[model samples]
Target: MQRNQIIRTRLGWTLLDGVERLVSALWPARFKGSVGRVLLLPAVLLIGILVIGLGYMIEYSFHELDLSTYRLKDEYSLVNYAVIADRPVYMRVLNRTLLAALIVSVTTVFLAFPYAYMLVRTRSALTRKFLLIALFLPFFIGQVVRAYGWLIILGKQGLINSLLEGLGLPTLNLIYNYPSVIFGLIQYMLPFAILLIVPAVAAISEDVELASEGLGANWISTFRYIVLPLARPGLIGAFVVVFTLTLTDFAMPEILGGGTTDFIASAIYDSFFQLSNAGLGAALSMILVMIGSVIVAAIFYLAGTGTLGVREQSR
Candidate 1:
């Protein structure tokens, strides 16, 4: 017994020493705020680049465009904005884009939440591995390839239509519509949502969940009161990612939206590249940047305030 105790003590000390060394190796050498600023210099420069680009766009948006020469005038004018406001078509497209983004974010959160919960909470090792691979598989595939795949799947007389025809049912029109756009956006955005939720869900200790169950709480109550709160951060992260992706989606809409549809990204592309209306394009690009900024701010506020979901760590 004495020998066994000695062995255990040695093992513990060795493990602790190894952990100390690992921690020393992993931790930043210094965490002084000034030192931290040095680390952030690269990030700062990247942000500066983005800000300067967007600033130029904003400046150009306010400049008068010489119609004949397609050159910008020095004078400031709200004519670009006025043009945007006067057109009901652009307003309608903007509203639809907002709605589409909201719907995609909400759907992705709901679908990925349950999947992430299952992945982390389930005991089956194979199941966990399977889900992890599936969640990340789309990342390996190029975005254009994924969009093209969707185009094939949703195209008229494609897989779904062929299946329906084989079963003697009428071929449904799935392509070139809102449904196609939503379907493509959801697939494109799901991986991000899943990745964000998995970490938060994994952070939830099993003991807390068991304690809730032991206290006479049903599965639904346990999830509502325990699991959901702990996974709030992940949900917030996922929502922000999915929402931003949806807002900036250009490929899916272009491939599946047919000719009639017009997303803000597509409109900007048309203005800048197609029509050579750089000023209008710049204005539209600025609008996109502003929309992205508003969303990022809102997500930060919601996550910081713990309004979006339950905070698991504090509990």
Candidate 2:
């Protein structure tokens, strides 16, 4: 009985292999190279839908909104954009958004670098596991939940203030301000920055650092000259990602800013929902997209878009 079972199992394996080869032979040669492209169809369709929506936005942006009927005018013009240009308030919001994005991106990168380096270079298994858990734990929580958590910690009667009061110190007001908003954004973006940097840091060979050190270079010198230059792609990638995310962030500024420090996204929200001016809102949305695109384009031009581990071929 055992000999018969072994023979049957071997025969079944041979038949399965034959069927697989037969199927492969029947598949057209022209279509074999397109398997990856076929997998990308879903992404292409998503982008197509987004482009169609953007087209509608562009059409709406050219028309003026009639406040009386709350309808868009049939006549197309640059009135919506003109309004943005003429109003100092719009420019101020844009400026604030840009400044906040710059601050958050720079700060996040500065803070994430050491964490990422340690995560990749650490020898202790326990330390690496701790770092990974800390890095990814926030991702399990939604951004809104985290923002609200910050409120619980930073609010007037929140934990920090409660602790201060217990210690016989004056309770401080910490939430609902520009600095608080920036602080929230930095905390939210740190994990992303570190994630982007880890792969780059990991890609760096330890032998290169050892070679530098053997050549009478100290650890600091090796890090500055060898490690940093090699990790440039990851650093640039993290900066761009955090900057773009911070620029368009709506919740942090809304929740932590206390309606006083509004970003561009807030202004856009007000135009559409509060004022019921779709044309103006569409215009604002387009402007925001353009601003983000231009900044990203400039970064790609300067940094060469090698952020995805693609290195230029050396001569």
Candidate 3:
């Protein structure tokens, strides 16, 4: 029995060795460091698709749409871009989008920081769990659903108005305005800002804050000096994300702005679908992309590459 067992073990070892040799032969030393590259293949493919789509858009932008035939002109020109430059409505929409983006980014960050700080610094497990639930609950709900929910709550004959009527107060006009759009955007973006900031806040050492307190620094002082500087990367990241998203937002402006406070996205939609002007829409899209890229580049330049986790080497 022992001899039979020993023979079986030797056979197993031989099979394993052969399998290893086969794997090594199939995957040579030159390809050993390619696992990460393999993992990145899907992302590269996605980016390639995006680039191809952008190329089509660029081509479309160069051609004028024939209103009579509802087709693009054979010749390429800058007539679509020229219309945007000459039209005041396009510039107005662009300006509104930019302003909304700035407001939403700043407001979201300000509101999110305190919530994130509490979530990270709380000693009670229940409080932490509650905070996490509140933060993530909105994420599961679709943005359109939430936007509609706001319409229900803030509509002229909605809950708030009903309550005001009960109390003999005038019903306020809450929805379908620029403020309402900004309000909805801030609500939608708050969770994202908190999520980005929490990691940065958690990375801060409790001992550092305690030491600052021991050295006679007040809580406000410690927070302002220590926490703010350390958590800047997350703040900048959240700001960039919120700003870009708000800048290109379609739903909030469409649903809440009620066509009166049209953003650039609304104009783009009208150009493509409502007006059947693909060339104009493509030009607007390219402009939006350029504006977003420039703003993001400016942020990286002003805030440094640290926001992207690339630290500068010491001199």
lDDT of 3 by residue, 1-315 (tens): 999999999999999999999998998878989978999999999999999999999999999999889999989999999999999989999999999999999999999999999999999999999999999999999999999999999998999999999999999999889999999999999999999999888888899899999999999999899889888989999999999999999999888878889989989999999999999999999999999999999999999888844476222
Indicate the worst ten consecutive residues by lDDT in candidate 2. 306-315
Model 1: ten consecutive residues of lowest lDDT: 306-315
Regions of candidate 1 where Cα sits further than 4 Å from its true position = 1-36, 302-315
Clashing pairs in 1: 229-310, 230-312
Candidate 3 residue pairs in backbone clash: none
Candidate 3, residue 25: how far the Cα is off, in Å:
6.9
All candidates' lDDT scores?
A: 0.84, 0.94, 0.93
Highest TM-score scorer: 2
Best-fitting candidate, scored by lDDT: 2
TM-score of each: 0.84, 0.92, 0.89
Q: Indicate whether candidate 1 or candidate 3 has the larger lDDT.
A: 3
lDDT string, candidate 1, 162-265, tens digits: 88899999988887888788888898888889888988898889999999999999999999999987788789889888888888788878888875566888
Error of 3 at 166 (Å): 2.4
For model 3, how big is the CA root-mean-square deviation?
4.0
